[model samples]
Target: MSASVANPNPNKSFEVVQPPSDSVTSLSFSPKGNYLVATSWDNQVRCWEITTTGATLSSVPKASTNHDQPVLCSTWKDDGTTVFSGGCDKQVKMWPLMAGGQATTVAMHDAPIKEVAWIPQMNVLVTGSWDKTLKYWDLRQSNPVHTQQLPERCYAMSVNHPLMVVGTTDRNFIVFNLQNPQTEFKRITSPLKYQTRCVAAFPDQQGFLVGSIEGRVGVHHLDDSQQSKNFTFKCHREGNEIYSVNALNFHPVHHTFVTSGSDGAFHFWDKDSKQRLKAMSRCSQPIPCSTFNNDGSIFAYSVCYDWSKGAENHNPATAKTYIFLHVPQESEVKAKPRAGTSGRK
Candidate 1:
């Protein structure tokens, strides 16, 4: 049986929606919040419609053959009509929501493309790969507008407030000013001596949080002169290395943030207090990716496993997709005592 836990408030619940494919690698919600996009090892990107009715939960995935190799990451454009995906085939494919669903492939990297992000305001597409380099592509042009080399392979990245943050396997996080995307502006080293699996910038763009394999999460200030740990949390005290951290998002109107790890669990915390507010049970397999809806009222995750079906098998190829609605605790509406009862005792 799968174990589960709830917080004092215990407001949210999850419903598992099986995808047509088994090895989903990443999950993203459309800007409109009506659809969820999942990239898988099946070399396909699937779009699922989210709905609740008739006492049943289901996902309708719009299957489209877009990549030749396993899709590693996917993201939606600001307009929500266009979707972008990168794969092991070293190609970045763009899928337009209209027409015949034609995919435009862009050859930008030599090695597997690990992550992709689109800057809507500047109309720039940024991708990082196993090539140890980050490239910025102008969608209007056929070639990469700029490229910045790093010391190690980059796995995940987040862009906000015109600043780009890249997470590398070298246990370092690099920040670049998009105003000058051609140069590396700052770097933050991990305190636990472990590689950063994922990095996410706060919604306010004032700081960022990094998750490491050592099961430690570090929050850092963004200002150059004020670089320091704002808060730290030990996810696992026994020192179990967190294989990966996929989903990180802040609530739409609150200081709360959510995170999911390879441990098959999702955690919610107050960014300011650094206190874990809730922990929810996840899929039995490792969660490879996660993202919140634009409104933060809903969240989704993709659970993936390696393909080893033997005695020492830990990672499997099959994966599952899940989506949940975050239900906030209802505030108590206490009625004030009668004015005459104040000192009666």
Candidate 2:
């Protein structure tokens, strides 16, 4: 049988979903909020539906596709009508939603493709690679229409309309304004010295959150006045070793966000109040990726070895891993008014 976890704490109840055979590298919620696609080190992209009723996994994977190498990342496009995935194979494949269709190889990269994002406003697909380049694609034809060199291999990226932020391995941020594809956009130095692990946009698009492998996260604002809202926190660390923060995403409605890390835990923080609302139960292995379903009703996370120590950590004898479906309590994320305890004295 596949792995499963049932925490006795009714308040933090969650259901284990059908898991991939190998490690999960990333997870993304479909735009419609009904399903989620997980890209895994098993060389497969698996899609599973998110049901409304319980903390139980309602169904098995709706579809599963394979890649030549271990898949690393995935994203939805056309409002969930299609999906795109990339991996160590250096190939990007587009999968259609309707049943019985094969995926199309959309493009290729010189090195592993670290990220694949669809610019809905521009109707284009952008991919960042360890090859030290960012390329824009037009699905109608082969080969990227434009390509720009980067200072270093891109490890994380976040988009909040108008602006695109690419965080590289060398502690540099390459920011771009979607409107003017050209022109050298702004460059921002990172606040931390560790390798960037994840970057997520704020709901309002004014700034973003950057998380590092050293268990440090910094808040950044685009303008001066909002800069006061910025803050930094150290978490996911135990004694000396710091766990890598694997994922960061904002709640669509509440504007709050959740952070997951290699320590196998998820924590909800209310940025407006500078307080942690909750920290979910920890699993046996690390949670490599997580995301909130579009409507904010459900959250999915994969628990597996994320290769943080490189191939040396891979153990074939390791037990099976899993993906879980959690229904966060409304009260846990419900935003508090300024007068509430999270606000002022």
Candidate 3:
């Protein structure tokens, strides 16, 4: 059964009222408000409104919709009033939140869609699928605006304005300059030695960070001149027992990031200083997905089985899923003075 533990600090974090009926696959915060959306393995997409009253935080279920198959990923439009979700059903559904409208299918793929993103700069929706292709949808049309073949099935993707990075099954990394969305800017293999679990672009758009199942992360820069700055670090391990780094999210303002892992722990780090900032207490179950709110004031994480052990180990009868809202203190997430250097890095 679930070995769930009590909240270590109730004031810092609180559990959401009602979470998904199944494992949560992804979590995203709206760009303009306190609304958070999650896509789950139960074929459902849910949105929650997070609010804080002095020292207490609470969540209210807002709106929800279902996919024909388990929803894999979701994204918010620039307006924050709409959401787009993709699933194993091979379809992308657009939901209008503020207007209280029904969701409608906007795009389709030949295979399960693993990741979805809304690019305000391009005014299009991008879907990466197991079909081994990256398709860009215009939303205005039934067909994709462009389809680019990938080296392998897309496993992870991260986008930051003019920069887009896609990590595929074979450790292939494809970087695109969205100013010219139709062409690839760079193609390289992952610096990590194992399959990529997650990826996040640097807020400055100069590089990207890739996490692997081997409990390691690689920091890569785009320019050859900055090649010396590239490095890798090991994390999410207990002695010789290592765990996959399942999610990586950069702070919107600080540029520092948080990494969640299969070991049921999460840590904040300053990439510029190459130093770990804070390591939170471990949960009873793995943290499958996590994200920072638009302002980085709140951190949302899912405590559930991540399926890293394959289908044989999942025990639905005993599995307990939870969504937590952690109000981060500025000192906990902000960067510190770099080593051997005075003042901020």
- Using all chains and alpha carbons, the TM-scores for the candidates as numbered come to 0.83, 0.91, 0.96
What are the RMSD figures for all models against the true structure?
Answer: 6.4, 3.4, 1.9
CA shift of 87, model 2, Å: 1.1
Q: Per-residue lDDT tens digits of candidate 1, residues 1-345?
A: 223431211323545455635566777878765677878877888777767564443566555656888998888888888889998999899888534488888646989999999888778888999999998888878889888898899877988857788988877888887787787888877655676777787767777888776667778887867665476777733244444455676665564677777666667776554567776655465555667777665666654453323336642332334444443341211122335667321
Model 3 root mean square deviation, Cα atoms: 1.9
In candidate 2 the C-alpha lDDT for residue 268 amounts to 88
Highest TM-score among the candidates is held by which one? Answer: 3
Superposed model 3: Cα runs more than 4 Å off = 1-12, 339-345
Off by over 4 Å in 2: 1-13, 54-57, 340-345
Instruction: List lDDT for all candidates, in order.
Output: 0.69, 0.81, 0.91
Counting clashing residue pairs in each candidate, in order, gives 4, 0, 0
Model 2, span 1-345: residue lDDT tens: 134653222234455567788888888888865777888878999887766553454645688899999998899995778899998999899999655579989978999999999999988899999999998998997989899898999899888778888999998988888897655478888877788999987777777889988888888887778777788898787789789888887888888888888877888888877878887777767778888888888877877778887888777676356777777787667666666456422
**Pairs in steric clash, model 1:** 22-319, 305-316, 306-315, 306-316
Selected candidate, larger TM-score, 1 vs 2: 2
Worst 10 residues of 3 by lDDT: 1-10
Model 1 regions more than 4 Å off: 1-20, 52-58, 236-244, 306-345
